[model samples]
Structures are given as structure tokens and as C-alpha cells.
Target: MIIVIEPDSDVPIYEQICNQIMEGIARGQIKPGHSLPSVRVFASDLGVNMHTVNKSYHLLEKKGIITIVPKSGAVISSPQDFNESSFNRLKDEFKPLIAESLVVGMTHQQIQNLVTSIIEDFTKNQK
Candidate 1:
């Protein structure tokens, strides 16, 4: 996986790492059962602190996107690994963003189109 980190961006480095990894998963660059680089190696490659990568991995674990095995490394989780609670958590997370979009005068159609476009962009390479 190629992760480009902008040190000057407002987004934290760990969050950027997390987002890129998630995007990689969406784009099918990293499939289920794929092993991620070790935190030390990834940090060295990315020129970031190991702690940052660890935080990102932990966050991914918490989000059910990956699992950290003892003495093994991180592995991508399959969709089947997600339970109802995971979906509920996702809904809860999206509520504020959707509400904010509506409050900002975005129409339902516009929001839907944006979502469709993002999904298409993410999955285009899979076809």
C-alpha cells in the first residue's frame, strides 16, 4: 500500500495514515487477509514515528477494518467480520456528517450523487 502523508496538512499524520489505508481497502489494493507492513518498517518507510503508525493500526482495529495478531502483524478484516453493532456505530458516526451537510444546504440528491461518485471512484479499479 502506498500512503502519501502531508506533514503540513491540518489532518494528523495518524489519521492520514488511517484514511489512506481505508481508501486502499476500498480500492482493492489491500484485500482481506492481506498483511500490512510492520509498524517499525512502515514508519521507517513513511518517515514517521512508529507510535503514529501504531495509533493508526489501533484505530483501524477499533473500527473493525483490521486485526492485530500477537507476534504476527496486522491483517485486513473481511466484510463478514462486521456485526450489527459495527453498522450501528457507522450510522452513529455518519449522523452528524449527514446533518451537517443538510444544514449546509445540500440536497438529498446532491448528497446521494456525491456518495455514488465516491463509491464509483473507490471501486473502479476492481472491475
Candidate 2:
């Protein structure tokens, strides 16, 4: 997966890195057991601080999206590991934003349709 960082964005570099890694996993571009580049290597490649990459890795681990080993580096978690309870938890975690979407004139059907389209696009890209 390619991670493009927007230097002009208000988001922090570490956050941008973390978000991209998580997005890669969500989109299946990065699969379970996939080893990420080492912190120093990624930082060098991205021209960011080593600490920034390190922080992103730790954040991913905290969210159960990756496993960080002392020397083995960070690995993506299995998609199968995201069970029904995990999905429900993620749904609950994002409930406030979803409610806000609804409040802003986004119907449930519209959101569903949008999500369906997104999934379709993602799958098509995979091939």
C-alpha cells in the first residue's frame, strides 16, 4: 500500500502515518502477518522523524490493528480477528459521528448506498 502524506494538512505527521496504515488494512492492501518497514526505515523514506513512525506503530498496536514485536517489527492483524464483537465495538465507537451524519441530512439508506459503493470500489481496485 502506498501512503501519501499531505504536508500542508493540519493533521500531525504521526497521525497521517497511523491513519494510512490503518486504512491499508481496512482496504485489504495490507494483509495479516504483513510486516511493515522498520521505524527508522520508514522515517528515512518519508523524511520524517523516527519518533513519528514509532508513535504511529504504537498507536496501531494500541488499537489492535497491528502487533509490534521488539525485533520482528509491526505486523498487520488478521482480518478474521475482527469478529462480530469487534465490529460492534467499532460501530459503537463511531456512533457519535454517524449520528452527526444523520443529523446533517444523510439518510440511512444513503449512507448504506455510499458504503456499498466504497466496498465495490475497494474490491475492484484489489484485482
Question: Pick by TM-score: which candidate is best?
Answer: 1
Screening candidate 2 with a backbone cut-off below 3 angstroms (N, C-alpha, C), the clashing residue pairs are none
Query: Model 1: which ten-residue window has the lowest total lDDT?
Result: 78-87
In candidate 2, position 106 carries an lDDT of 100
TM-score of each: 0.96, 0.85
lDDT of 2 by residue, 8-96 (tens): 79999889999888778767788889999999989999998899899998988877888988889998887666677668878997898
lDDT of 1 by residue, 2-108 (tens): 78999999999999999999999999999999999999999999889999999999999999999999888999999898799999999999999999999999999
Score each candidate by Cα lDDT.
Answer: 0.95, 0.85
